[model samples]
Target chain A: MSYHTLQHLTVRLLFDEKFVKFVYEDPDSALLGLDLSKEEKAQLLAIDSRAWSYDSLRRLRTMRSLVEEFKASTTLVLAETRQLAFLDKFFSSPQFHDSIQKRGSMGLAFAEYLSEKFRQKELKTPQLADVLRLESLMARCRREFQKIRVTPLPKTLKDDLRIKFVPGADVGAFQANTVLTIQKIEKYLFEVNLMPAMVLCDDAPRLMDLPAVETKKKSYLMCVPAANGVSLIDIEKSDYLVLIEARSSLTIHQAIERAMASGITKSIAQEIIARALEEQTLHLV
Target chain B: MTKFFDKIAKIPRLGVGISGEFGSANKGIEACLLQENYPELVHFFEYGGDLDRGLDEHVRRWASTGLPTTYHFLDINIEERIDLTSDWLVETIEMAKEINATWLCGDAGRWHFGRRERGHQMLMPPILCMDSVLESVDNIRQIQEQSALCCLPENPPSVVYLGEMHILEYFAEIAERADCGILLDCAHLAIFQHSRNLAPLTGFDNFPFERVIEMHIAGGVLKETNGYQYIDDDHSPEPLESTWQILKYVIERAKNLRAIVYECEHNAAEECLDNFIKLNEMFPCKIETPKLTVK
Candidate 1:
């Protein structure tokens, strides 16, 4: 129990590069106020000076995983600026680091951090906020889907089958057309076959030549866990209403009725329900 | 001797180990399963998963085959009292039961600093002192009691170790106080000895070999940075000579040893076959026929 402080300090040494250097320079001064024992203090001082390089390697590993998790957002950030300044600022923030320590999804936490920056007008990129939001929702949906024991879909949506929105399925409204913007980003990434190594080395070709996206129209998209990855489906306000009603376990007929009560035409409600089942966004139980 | 000794003796030899996202990536056991001769090579799976991530489809598929499995956790910090929450224990036991795990095992190291998160995850060796050992003992005992399964504490790999006690002595004291089994990861021990400039078998003279229920053999890469040379546990097919030396020293001494896992999940089947043949030559399976097979 008493060694918790030692454990805490050691973790900081491994992760916080600045602190590692401070400790490496003057161990006694850096660890002055801690309640560690004399032997523990000696142990702390004995840490290899080369730990900074190890920590650098660890940070690279983290970046590699983050690239995989937030592909679209990372692609946009890199493509727009051709530099890692945005990422550097985000990774260095104490708030983001605290989120990582708290076991939060790195994608979701980064999305939240970017949203804050956008709110404060810190970000000038027109479509960056919407792109990050889209990726964050997809990441959340994927995580929620992973935690559930998914039941196999029936051959067809039967009248007797109970239907509900897949656990963690969510909808978002964005100022920019995220679906089209992501499609362009994916195509750009595919054409270049961007590798983390290239990005790390600053050898990646400048992508600033890409055309700016239109950011005036409001776009509605639903993110759901798909068979391979997350699926972002373009939808109308009517479809969103139907999906919201389907969140609770209900028969297809009941969902349609609720949608109709919400001012969605019965035929439109039926059509959206049928399409949701086909996309596997709404599951039969 | 405790009941865990007999329980672990039932585990088959020549198992395969995988951790992290190896299962999801279709590496580790998946690669081995693709081989036509895997039935002769792999007897059981040491399914290592983070409790937060749960098991993936590949692990579930392996479990569906009714193969023997042992759950190796990657999330818990057994040395930190705050990390041993009741909720964590419940979730861990649930995951172990889901895979029908034979027992539970993980490295007795600081898995994370404050909370068990992906960013904070690491494999630093415990501060090798009596207080750390006592704390770890209490935690291991709690895990064993809560899960009703034998808990084996593994010695974590580290480039730099701290404290007056040797790594072997630290784990030996925990095994005695907790009344549990031990998982002797030879590669990790090799790394520790090389870091301290000690012989491979320097500290084994007083170790509780009989308490060792499992042994791990993993490939490591030797690299030097800033005038410090250390073995990195990269899980390649070619294990260091020091690892093999440690394994050879303990093979006969570990009286209760039931498992010797080749942590070559990242290697291709052809690349691992040579080591598999070598391991089979050293410890032949007790059962004449393979217990698990892939279609």
Candidate 2:
């Protein structure tokens, strides 16, 4: 328990800027509650506040991992504002630390945090919310897929094959064409990857000019794990309904019946099922 | 005392190391393999991975070539009791079996503070105290028993250290208590010495040198910020003199040393050749290099 307390204090010193300042200014007051030995207190006090300050190597390392995990979102945010002010707020928020303690996915936590910001009108970029949501869903799907073994489909789908949604598949509706927006982001990332030296040069064009996403219409998307990576497929409203129903074990006939009851025509329902099977979004049981 | 002698003997003398997507970007392993003098210099591959991230195809392909390999985990915090999850242990054993790893090794440091999240992940050294030493011993024994592989705890690198015990004394206690071998990383030791303002070989005399089965050498940079000077373990091709000094001292003392890994997966092949040649000379491999003839 003492070791745990030491570790907790160490983590707080590295991450919580407020606590670092408090400890730096008033070590005795900050050390009042904690049950630490004299040597432990001395060791904790010996930590140089400047070494773990903002822009420290440890923070930079964390920033690198976040930027790598959410490259497109980071680039888009960077391009729009030229600064990650929201990240500063996030780092200070209790949710960030809670996510770390709970052992939850940071990508998902950030996406949820950004969602809350957008909901509160704190974030000006509307399209970024959709992008973050899609990215979060894809990351969750990939992680879930890693846990469950995917049963390989036979060479052919039988006529009476029972079908179900893949174990980690998910569907969502967004205000913007997130798939297309992500494609544009990927294109920008590709350019950045090709010109590494250009990225290092401040004077060089910071990034490819990304146009604002048109928010006139809504886009439905299905996220599923593919062989190489996570795959995003654009789906129609009817396709979404069918996949939702397919969450339960259903034969092809039952899936079509369920879709028809939801006002989808029989032919359309059959067609969606066929396409889903081909895409491996729905697997035969 | 010789519980791990057979496992130690199975490890090759001269090896190259790759950790977590290191070789995929630069093809450092491929570069080493392309060299005409590769056989004489390189003896085995040390695969460092986190079970959470899984292994990449490049590492698997190299591993499947029937070359000897050792598994180095990057995720587990050996001093934290809560980190030794059964699921993680099972996956660790599976990964080792998949790669046919000769033995397992990892830095016995707090890899993460609270839990294993990306934002929390860091290679911070444990608070060098008796409490931490006992905790690390228990974790090491658990891992060694569960995985059925000789687990060697390596010293983690850090700019700032806390506690009353020296880093050498900390690992020596763990090795003695856990009854396990140790992986002495010269670069990390040099960093600890530089940070604490001690000589590189300051504590080498008291260490359990006979328990050292593996050694690691990497390049580092002397950096200063806000008047705080420290060494950064950057894994460059140019190693520091202090690192070489520690390696020399250990080489003279660690009679059970079986493997020495040059952790230069990010450096270009030409940039690494001199160091590889130096390692080969310092700890020559038994395998013979073929002579190139003019056509």
Candidate 3:
């Protein structure tokens, strides 16, 4: 399979998006697509999800076991808890082990593993400085190892959407246009909407390490925070939109603080930006 | 082993403030230092989601001043963004050597599912298991763990696990098996309180109670969403009523508890720490200080 297809399949399976859409969008059509025998489909669909609540995974070894199970399944179906209880009904069923493994879903396994690690007691008390340093190192390692995709928005709509999450409200029409010249954009909307942002774009520049450009007009050097990477700087006043490619999304407050620290005048605080945008939209409409 | 919440409510001078990243707000620290009753310990918090700044700078700023302090490895944040492992251990110990730190506190291997997702749906670090904790504790326990620094044995320090209540029994069993100590945070226990009106630290009855070496106090409020609730939100300002109540209860019950550290953030953290100091003064023996020398 193509790597692209594999990634797409992974997302579809991880989130159950494709399966959910198929079930709700067209039950008969979905049933037709299932490779299982008619009896199997009936048995699978009739299973209750609440009957079998598997224990959560709180350790890496256990989580790894769960991951291995998921990777092995070809046509994995999340068996309902009752369906799990009915395993005896299909004693010779091929999906029995898979069903048991599915009981300890990825979420359950990962959350449990994290909980165990976070909760374990320490023998030797570490200095807070040392602990923080370890925490920083671990955090970097996690980010660097995890792979992800970055997608940009339509040029015209990116800024408008980004401004909506700025807390104060929307940005002015002029500020929204500033996104066009954006070499980097890091906004919270990208994460929430589940659509990759320009911050993940291949060509976006590092917002923090911009070259000094000689411009005729006074421009705003916007500092946008990249939660997983560097902060951004915008020097173009003509364009309202600036695009940022990111390794990951920034927390809501972190993004705002990053923007302010980037030299956004207090005059352009969230509220002011929203008000200006509203006035501009009114004039244009 | 003083119960952390009571100390926090009872003392007023023990409060300290924490910033997410080191040096993100030095100006704020300068302002804080201006206060007469400023706390001796200030935590510079950083995680994976934060900007990449070397820990050296934060350690330098804190160490440059000869004040006794702590630097918390808000490891959860770092776990979210890094490929953490034994290498991280070497670097952290080296950094500790450089700073001459008395103690180092970090997460066991837990992840906080906050407002956003960082692709953990794909890959996450190996969970910190009882065995993992014991192994790490044993590694740090070795005298050669840091041949460069001379830290005292009296304050041998502690390893803390910020996790569920029931898991305490398992942890205690592991600790007993390993002959190591633990730093118990009262607020975390309260967060794990279940439908049983039993105290959050009830599980400590199963552990080698004598091995508990430190306690943490903080104001924590239960947050409810979709009719479910949990504890350990650092953003909380004042210590919650339940948190303090649990602390007092733990103090009454536990025998091996030691130094109580008041953990909080912003102005509320200061206020909480102040209450902790007063508790220490009011009830000194209950919150015993371990006298270990660091060379």
Candidate 4:
């Protein structure tokens, strides 16, 4: 794929007055209110579920509560779903702008939804149904906030295996503990501040450099995780909180072996990354 | 006294100074230019968004374009990322060194810890302070201990904001005592005049004249915000008349004014440098040079 191809045109045709009017008129209904074939409807539902799963199930619950509380209009809900669909298509498409831009547009849409809802709350004049629509629209916007592109840093920095691995033989031994530690760090960051500085990516290293976790130095610990990798993050360069699911445990090992990974070093980087990520995520959440 | 006169006298032959302290830098240089004090021009290039070239490339581009001396302000997004450990800091300083910048001016990036980390010794200037005058002097002292390059308080006192005069005096004394020369930004002193309540700088004429070694001049705007519109050096326009007057006053008083920089944002406003030329025509001072012809 061409590196500079323009993808994520969410904002490109977004200013169209007619389409906007249609969204306002009936959000829950499909765009144009045309009947969907059974297969198309199923596909749309599948896409919706896929998006919900991408972030977490908690957001779905939030949306349900908002729908109930606001008695939202079908139009606002439909508008939001369409917005989500647009985002999903944009991210999943071959034409992803760098992940950061994707993240920004998604964030903007969500903010707009919330801002609109907040505006609705202050109004003494809007009908109950319109208020509901506003709430539904806001909820839909919130759901797709983290759809971002993942661009790797310069290869000179990323190519070294020394940069990717954590040390300790029992490192894989504490796989569950590692995951739990990451979660705790995330929680701590969120509690203190919404924006987490670190992002952990265990997924394909080729896809991301994982600036958050740094395992450069070696150390000792009581129990080491069976499988986990870490890198230390520099928050100023990359602004968003991060998470990575390494595709395989062996891949994690290879990274460690190449880096001469030590369990202690990994743990330290993990702890810092975890805190930074938590701070960032808390900000976003 | 010969050491002082020799330095001031040779300023026109060497590169002009490029100071990026908002208003004063531009005004000071303009005052020099108007008096026919044509020192080599120092352009303080402030990077804006969506520009393709990095710092080195920017310096090279301007140098190749025939500007005598080019310095960077290192402001904008770079300043916001004050965490010097970040690659941006490393790259920016490396660029400054590569370009042989006479001064690399900066403010603390947001979220800065205000500590110098090891492995960052190769960078230039080593100044860490921004915004506050007192903190700036302390940082300047700390940096001076590490390197010969001068550390500048990002903006000098405005003749307009009298609240700033004492702090400015404090900094002037420090600079004098430290034996470090001043990057007297002309625009900031002009901002002092725009504010009515602050005491004008008439009585404080003897403030730190020996410390000044460089001058800056640039154009800016007069905009209204919060029901008050005032001149700000962030944008470029014709030099403020009051700013030019004050700069002329500085040239006559200071015995050690070395280089004068005509600092402006790249493509800041339509007539930024032209204003510098026009102001030069109006006053006609000592340094020798022809009006800058823009063909």
Candidate 5:
């Protein structure tokens, strides 16, 4: 076969499954106008079996699975086939972006695909962007959790009680624009109990137990790492601000001074600092 | 440490294979990246899924750890796309540049290992002229030349239905014509023999060992399919006893080796690290001094 023709067939075989079918359906026409050997032609045609078709379909299916995992961690759980349908839209869309093969890029591809679907009015959902934005932030949070450095709290330093917040503490940086409430997501570990260090959340079933509040206002998320998954905890905005201020190394006296001066009574101010240390909102440097 | 493979003079760089321990390869990568000690070069599969936020976030982890990180990306689809080549170039090679990757590694064609031999056979693009061997070579050369990053194509695992072509002959001509090095996937070679229903290429003579700049060895399960037996590398199967033996054969012959990687993502972190240490012991970073200087 001429080099270019061989190259063309070879490339098509590696990329297009449809062409593979076309070749299989009409072997003579497929082999015509080309210079493949008897062996080469037979080999290409031999791929007409179930085993070969399954392999190609498996790879394409894997691309769908990749984004499917991202979707699982980001948005509300959907039926397996439902998620697959969403992915099918992207894979079948005119814009293929990259092969949604990589974990991070698959999410972007799905998000873009979802946005396009929303634009076309193909999807009947009004919260397309909201869902994508939420899932992307959770994915980001997971990445950030990996980067967190967990240091040992030196004994003498721990006794000092001046360092309130740990080195890798952040409250308002969840990266999601939507105000996620604890009531909405008892399962949302990405926001509620967010921290990297190993945490044993005692009978304290969740975040700073703000029971009286009906909705979590723009709150702080504490991502705490456990054995298998991350725990996202919700904290009051004021309390979160206090933890941020504690980054300046507020000693027990300074902390009480700041809390009291900010209009809290002496006893409440003392309890707040004690609570921060106990919960590891503050740790020894 | 001065040592001689067939042609190499320097000690080879080393890397660990990163695969998701739980379910996601990306998750395993996140955990691997957390290691205080990581190689300057890494081989990645499915590591580029999310660029703007997901993969980018993980890439940023390498920043404070050190400077100038180089990743060897294997997740990219390498088979030529007449029109898609340019966009693929932008997505992969450009992504490599953005991440400070030194070399982009990909299989020559048919990136995955399928149950059936013909799975990868369907990707041939239709063009009218040129030799297949040289055309494939040009495809690699064009990619290597176009990208700021160095591109190395690895050999695909062989199957019986495919047209007969020796891996060594294919790599030798491509290396010579494209001026490109090979990322020799030893597992693919092992499975190639198994899948092709042929005896092993026991003798190493005439093989283009010098063209191989890097090597990949992974643990695979012993498998039987269609009356043939081979080692399967997909699905992170546990390694068989002879896996290391096969690896030793290739490492000894790859004189120009710059990196010898142990694919351990499928195994436990401790087990993978232990395997990594064991391989390092066999092929130490500091090459043993030659017994006698050549006069």
Candidate 6:
């Protein structure tokens, strides 16, 4: 291997426990089969691995931090003991191993893992998975939305929703009580509200507040990103569908047309659209 | 543009400061520097999220101290990652310019293992060759040119020495090659001293002292694992007694010293600020107020 590659491997030896174990135990599988000199191998072997052995690409701490920050409710649900365990398991599992390749945002990766676990019915506290997914997406939405330095909505709101996530595709939809059941676990983690044809999570306290809340559920919630404030807002059902359809090739007016076709009056559609805009649930199209 | 060294040379006094990259003002660290007991120039280890939002807020936070700064990037090991990108540097230097940073500093050693996009489980073995020195020099030139700011290269502490050349001499030659100053992290120097098995500050005359535009003073626990001693740059907020001696030695010897930074990335901010008080008692006005931070 080239010198850069060799240097990389040596530093890798410093951090990776699995690589060190293989090198010390197997002695068969060399360091990436590199043409390491005896002195080089000797240097690699001489490191104090125990200090850095647990860090592994420095993600255990990083992912753990993200889980602590974004998925505070999930963190509470997992309790203190399982926090590291979940992160370690996630790190070692395919969910972490396969997707951890995207190095820029560890929060997004951890969120994806929770979302996938929720989708696959693999979570122990399934409701916590929902909260984790919501928290993660909120963080992502806030970050993505900030880059779109526009006050008014784009002319083509359907093609570029200003926000990248969709309701049903990126976020899961749940009945009012199911969400309320999840929220009841930690009402402060999320706010459940009763809105016309939907439950609104807009104008709720930030996840950091996790205030005491009542477990009142309405019709439904679709976790959609508010186009600003790095906030995540969930909208109610039929209205959620309108925003979902509007996130594509349809304009705001077109989306309202679709909602009107689905037995909704123009006034109700206008009210929902106004509420969506007011809550930052949907940007102008 | 007048080189940063030229401007800082005008300051004409030994300076004292600590890493300003602590997460928030509520951490109780900012109060330490602001206290009347210490005169400080702030240095940032990093400003998170690039120059995204909060650029003005971050710049104002550092500028509020009205202390001079040496904004340093400790992550990109110029020696190792010759292929480092310039995009982030653009935003970082822009922020530094806004903060009126005296110098933009980084390390001569490599810190990261591999590229971020790949999920690598290993770190690149430390590259200690002469080419690494050359690579660092080139990295300095490219960064300085792109950032439109004066760049200083600091010597990083290492667990493994991978080249035949001595670390001190390598630092000296590279500073001369890069046409920039050096940010001497004294804690790193102590580790290098131990790793080389040299008597404490035994051959200090050989390295390039004049090139050091900034000095990073901090301490780490000397961790022994498997018969090897590595400086874990995590614990111990104050510079160790030995590191203090080296700092004094550098202060006595160097001609072009400007700032001394107390890097306590893991330690509390108040503790880092307290270091200046101890530094003053030990060195007796050797450090006043100078520039920088780490990332």
Estimated TM-score for each candidate: 0.70, 0.74, 0.41, 0.40, 0.48, 0.64
Query: Which candidate number has the best TM-score?
Result: 2
Evaluate candidate 5 and give its CAPRI docking class based on DockQ.
Answer: incorrect
- Which candidate achieves the best DockQ against the true structure? 2
Candidate 4 local lDDT, B62-113, one digit each (tens): 4343333423433322221222233444454555555554444432211111
Candidate 2 DockQ, CA atoms: 0.30
* Candidate 5, superposed: residue stretches over 4 Å from native: A1-36, A45-285, B1-26, B29-34, B37-54, B67-69, B74-94, B110-130, B146-149, B158-161, B222-231, B235-237, B286-295
TM-score of chain A of each: 0.66, 0.68, 0.19, 0.17, 0.39, 0.54
RMSD of 1: 7.5
- Which residue runs of candidate 2 sit more than 4 Å off their true CA positions? A1-19, A27-41, A53-61, A64-82, A86-89, A149-167, A176-219, A234-285, B6-21, B24-41, B51-67, B81-100, B110-121, B204-206, B265-295
What tens-digit string does per-residue lDDT give for candidate 6 at A8-69? 45543443466567777765464545656676666556644554453333655555456545
True contacts kept of each: 0.32, 0.46, 0.00, 0.00, 0.24, 0.18
Which prediction has more favorable TM-score, 2 or 4? Answer: 2
Per-residue lDDT for B152-188 in model 6, tens only?
7767766665655566777778777777877777787
Candidate 5 yields a Cα-based lDDT of 0.49
Task: Report the C-alpha lDDT of model 1 over A110-223, residue by residue, as the tens digit.
Answer: 667767877888665776777788778777777566435457766666666788877767777776556677777777677567564564455565455444555566777888
For candidate 3, give the lDDT: 0.35
After superposition on all CA atoms, what RMSD does each candidate show versus the true structure? 7.5, 6.1, 21.4, 21.5, 16.2, 9.5
Better of 4 and 5 by DockQ: 5
Please report, as a residue range, the 10-residue window in candidate 3 chain B with the lowest summed lDDT.
B150-159
Query: Global lDDT of each model?
Result: 0.75, 0.76, 0.35, 0.36, 0.49, 0.56
Interface root-mean-square deviation (Å) of every model: 3.9, 3.3, 15.6, 25.3, 10.4, 6.2
Off by over 4 Å in 3: A1-285, B1-21, B24-36, B39-52, B56-59, B76-84, B111-165, B195-198, B249-258, B268-274, B282-295
Candidate topping lDDT: 2
lDDT of 2 by residue, A1-285 (tens): 566677666765766677678888998887666768887887877877766653365555676777766776776677766666656556666566556554556666766776687687766665677788777777677655644444676676555779887766878777666667777878767877787788668676555545566667778888887776578777788888777777778888888888889999988888888888776778778
**Per-residue lDDT for A182-226 in model 3, tens only?**
222223222423644653566543223222322333334333224
C-alpha lDDT of residue A244 in model 5? 55
- Give candidate 4's whole-model lDDT: 0.36
